[model samples]
Target chain A: MSPLAENSGPDIIAAVIGLGSMGLGMAQSMKRAGLDVVGYDITPAAVDRFVADGGRGAATPAAAAKDADIVVSVVVNGAQTEAVLFGPQGVANAMKPGAVFISSATMDPAVARDLAQRTEALGLHYLDAPISGGAAKAARGELTIMASGSRQAFDTARPGLDAMAAKVYELGDEAGKGAAFKMINQLLAGVHIAAACEAITFAAKQGLDLDKVYEVITASAGNSWMFENRVPHVLAGDYTPLSSIEIFVKDLGIVQDMARSERYPVPLAAAALQMYLAASGAGMGRDDDSSLARLYAKLSGAELPSSTKEPQSL
Target chain B: MSPLAENSGPDIIAAVIGLGSMGLGMAQSMKRAGLDVVGYDITPAAVDRFVADGGRGAATPAAAAKDADIVVSVVVNGAQTEAVLFGPQGVANAMKPGAVFISSATMDPAVARDLAQRTEALGLHYLDAPISGGAAKAARGELTIMASGSRQAFDTARPGLDAMAAKVYELGDEAGKGAAFKMINQLLAGVHIAAACEAITFAAKQGLDLDKVYEVITASAGNSWMFENRVPHVLAGDYTPLSSIEIFVKDLGIVQDMARSERYPVPLAAAALQMYLAASGAGMGRDDDSSLARLYAKLSGAELPSSTKEPQSL
Candidate 1:
């Protein structure tokens, strides 16, 4: 029988590891759905914030995993995910047999399959569930998840998935399918953001108003979700890091690595990755990814719309 | 006094030069709006089609310009626009003085300014009015025009602009601003198409279905206007050139030239231009712009979804 079949009620316990921006929001979403939720983070402040928000906080991943029916790992990348599940003070062996472990990091498909196999060997279900929609959607329980796993794993995680995501695309019955889909999303997202920056800064170079460029492009054939979402930051001259340049540096790097392994040439994504690397190296890695416009302006000596404050350098 | 002010009536004679896809539709739209519309094209068949669609056809550029109050040049680029205006049998000295000349070609801002200055010297008002929304919108009289020029130029062209465009963004009181805005739009459009091709092909490499990638991406942050509009062609394996890859080679070539003049680095647009150039070199230049996906698949040895017919080679 499945763990969900065994529970058969609202008594399922869920633990959320890596309670940072995305994880804390997911923990709150689970708590709102009436699951007994425990949250842990490497940063103690994040755990304390989650506890103050009326969820349980655990000191370690193992403590959080103890007796949990589902453990959702929302870490940064494959390394962090592996550390949380199989590192020293890891939670894999601590989770009850038949429990589902959901991996929500952007990772390589090969790495995802390896981790899934390791989790299954320990009598736990592994669902490859990489997320989209950023932290704002995470807080609203309105994320989009590209997920794949065994039938039993889907059945076991459906309730929590419902609590966390507005749309959960069941891509396949394999462990790495979701990760592959996420890599594709990241590839487009990263490229679009870089393209937006390039176009807007080019507009700046030509003496067109950035605000007007944003207005016209949004209603024209050139528009993208990233363009509409991120151009405002450039127009307002804010680099407050809703998503950072470093994120694309990491995500598009993963895309390039995977493409290399597959012998595929992703020239657009590869080009976009270099822009993010340029921005990150210029000490704006933690700023809003829209800092790409600033980087372009600095390189070309074009004046952008004045910002409220000078951008800080790392 | 402005030509429109002298007339102060509904009577205006408009000629559309270069009756290609966009120009032909725009000519039809002008006729539908009850203007005295005349059209000319280098291709005799295009002129015949315009006449069959209930518009007058002209034998040459001067024939189209004779007695016309507004002349709209919807040619391919700066060269074509200049050819139709100042070449042997050009129309610069043929149109009535104080009549408007609307240049709808995507050209460099400096070239647009030069054209505007030359037209003004010939006692014709020049409006740098480049259009968007493609041929369908042109036919519906629902295009978006990014326009700038002298007040008299705008006044003379207002009636035709109303008949042809749904939104006319008055960008500035100069001749180059409209062209600048159009270049910005082309930069994004070209890059987004290339990005879409890269992402979809990467998905194919990962063994994900292209149709499913299309579905998921259209609903995800990865989506762009080009992705939503062009991926259908890829999915159906139809490359019957709604817009050809060579168009980007020209358009993005303009973008690069403008960027080079400004000493601005447009890495994304540059990268996208390379993809389009590669496609063109591989004999898919006249195919749909989405053939970048096919090129990537060929390069990586990945099979795409079965098409209705085999892709043709040069």
Candidate 2:
């Protein structure tokens, strides 16, 4: 679908129902864009932190949605999204009729479509809007959002989208397309990151200079954005999670589920999923994704820089 | 080692002992740089074609090396390189003493070191150089050469390298260093190509707009140089061989061998190699490396654009 045209609207009261790193940054971005933002999170400390940062906090998602013109669900998956909308004190009955719900969780496209259907039945619009660009860009209001929904949903969510995204691809006039596209991106991302880790660690195994390998590769055809972005963490031996290994374990697990249902043979993605699983299984689940290199290092007894605050190994 | 410094040579003559696309291009590049270049190939037609392209052609490697100051062997692997240097009518003894032999084949590092020892024992310089940037870059003298050798070897090969390479990385002062780096690159390159093919065809199976996927992915973190360069071929359904599947089969085979000997587990490269092998076995051995997409399409019954003169599917 062609992207929605440049949109404008009257005052928007936005409810951000999850003040994690990504959601908090997105909430601040909405406030900066002149939206009256209400934040809520299951963690009271998180809600307190958001309120301390000068945004109002709500006792529950339902409370946050009560006065919201748009409710942005920035939770992790379909289950959490469903809970926020239908659990005790759910936002479905609390929000005004015609108020839009924007789901930014990465979940099964089928789940996204079903959520859209249920939300529409409740006299609300649902936008399947899965976000990219991580927390830093989230804070900068420069996220890339892949979204699909009806024209009414687009109109209702325009203010939040404009505030939160640098690029919003309006995929279609229905849900699921955005989720499918996000899943594809996730598949490639997972594969590329694992490949990069494999390359760097294997280079280390060969006793070649890691920095030179990085230089030559970035200048050569073997480079990916993941390699360029994540290798520094490996080189530093840092395992502090910029994006953890568990994220890919979950994302690629979703891909495997989706591909299996479709009977699609995604050999590369499947292979990549194994690497993430192995890394997560090796107890690096919460470590940076580049820790796949550390996994290889541990398995092969190939030494990487032990320059991290604490050394990471098997 | 730092790249060979700029040097002046007195009437240097170079021999290119391979008239394939890459060798012909390198020979032409050398001739363009004012080096008198003579070319040879196993296929008489290739030599004839080179002669037809305004070049001198030799009957054999020895004949090509007879009056040369630098011999560049741009063959396929260590075995071919050994044949060029020591087989019947080999170039090793035929070339003048002190003339450098530059081996631009991807091979195991141990094999490269062995070949370097043999060449050096014959009172000659052996520069372990494996090339990148495909035929177009070779034709334009813009190839990137990862090279390592003695200072004398660098000085001896400098003129031809200046003509043939846009960037020559002086990896170290050893013959195997270049080969090691090249293998690392091949490991990543092969994996990326296979991953790109898997991603696009998988995207196709999901009924995505392939063009839009190309757009979104190139803008997203999932992108690799291979994906950006190769997916257009899939989008157009053209499996015309830009680089054949067999190339990766051989390269990744070498990687498997190296990693096995090193006791390093290269699961990602190993996985990628299987896809290339499967594609080759499925009769795409000479088709574009991107034909992995064709394989996925065949296996999953995914429909891609059949815009090519010939449809590509099982």
lDDT for A42 in candidate 1 is 92
Docking class of 2: medium
Candidate 1 docking band: high
Expressed as tens digits, the lDDT of each residue in B1-314 for candidate 2 is: 11121133438899999888899999989877878788999999998988897677899899999889899999999999999999999999898889999999999999999999999999999999999999999999999999999999999999999999999999999999999999988988899888888888878887888899999999999999999999998888788888899999999999999999989988889888998999999999998899988888888999888764765444
Model 2, span A1-314: residue lDDT tens: 11121123336789999999999999999988878889999999999999898788999899999999999999999999999998998898899999999999999898999989998999999999999999999999999999999999999999999999999998889899999999989988999999888889989988889999999999898889899999988888888888889889888989999989999977788888898999888888988899999888888988898873865544
Q: Candidate 2 overall Cα lDDT vs. reference?
A: 0.90
Q: Give Cα distance to truth, residue A166, candidate 2, Å.
A: 0.9
Q: How many steric overlaps does candidate 2 have?
A: 1
Query: Candidate 1 — which residues are off by over 4 angstroms?
Result: A1-10, B1-10, B309-311
